[model samples]
Target: MAQAPSTRLAENAETRKTRLRLWLNILRTARTVENALREEMRVSYDQTLPRFEILAMLERSESGLRMSALSEQLLVSNGNVTGIVERLVQDGLVERLPVPGDKRATLVRLTHKGEAVFAEMADVHERWVNDLLRAVPPETAQPLIDALTTVRRQIQQD
Candidate 1:
């Protein structure tokens, strides 16, 4: 039998409320994890998350990324990346090179020192995340990952 308009409306309203609660819960969980990771990075490595992220990005690239491209990949302003890149350059962990034929563009790449440091950090970071999410079984997490992937695609479409 076809449902009445009032019944359908009530179901839709209930779903909307459930979605709002779910969104809040996800936000809270993400913030908690991020805070913990930030604290661990500071205490253990004397490093900030942004620095680690920059190194990780460079570590994945062979030839390296242009300054603007790195900023874009990180979803941050060029100014933000500039300061960090300057510090990394000073620390001898990263190097900046001129992009041939583009006088305005500079490419940033990990130095050998950076590669070694990031390798150690990556190992510890993985273990930390694994320990934090130890309670979530692979079977349960896989469905969540699938659902989130679909949500991400839907969001990008919007």
Candidate 2:
């Protein structure tokens, strides 16, 4: 026989609660990891996570990135990116060039010094992350990665 309406509703409610708990756990774990990384960056490099992220992004772009485009890629406001770029420029770690077509736009790229510094920092950063997540071996991590990929696809579809 088909299940009664009340029975189905109860099952749905339980599933909702389970999903909520999973979400909370994921959030907690992410925050903990982010906090640890932030502290490590500050202590070891005298830099913030955001600054590191900017450098990483710039490193990926061969010709550099437009200021606005960089902010968009980082999912941050232009003003926030402007401040960081200003500091990076001041430190001689990055340089800004005028965009050929758009006088209002500027392209930002890493200096040679910045490239050397980031190479060292990136090595240490990888080791730090590996140490932090040592408990999750490759076998266990693959399934989690697949599940998260599914969740991301579902979210994007919605």
Candidate 3:
């Protein structure tokens, strides 16, 4: 037997409300984290988190990543990523190189300066995470990370 339509509608509405609440709370926390990172970057390093993220991503990638790939990884629109990449290119933190086999394609690689910046940023980034997480005991923090990862994986799977 099929379930009634109204029951399904009510369930969906409740789920949507619950999801919105969760997202709102998560956004609030993220904003706080961003502000803290921004302060650290500006006051201590004279760099922004986005610049750090781009350099860090390049540092971890062997040959580097394509603009499209970087957009996906950064979860930003292609145009936005392009603009950031252009700025970094001008700053000499990154350079775009021809994809030898693909004339139409290009890959962005970190320069020596970018790598140095990334190394410095990484140390401060780790300390930021430690300071943020230290407020909660490891037992509590570990479970939170586990739970959040589970939820993120489920959402991504969908």
The CA lDDT of each predicted structure is 0.94, 0.93, 0.87
Query: Over the stretch 35-151, how does candidate 2's per-residue lDDT look in tens digits?
Result: 999999999999998899999999888789999999998999999999999999998889999999899999999999989888898999999888888889899999998999999
**How many steric overlaps does candidate 2 have?**
0
Give per-residue CA lDDT, model 3, range 1-158, as digits (tens): 87679989899999999989998988998898889988888788777777788888899997999888888899999898888889899988899998889987779999998888778789978999789757788779878889899999999999
- Model 2 scores a C-alpha lDDT of 0.93
TM-score of each: 0.94, 0.92, 0.81
Off by over 4 Å in 2: 1-4
**Candidate 3, run of 10 with poorest lDDT:** 129-138
Give per-residue lDDT, candidate 3, residue 97.
95
TM-score of 2: 0.92
Better of 2 and 3 by lDDT: 2
Q: Which 10 successive residues of model 1 have the least lDDT summed? A: 1-10
Which is the better candidate, 2 or 3, if ranked by TM-score?
2
lDDT (0-100) at residue 9 of candidate 1?
Answer: 90
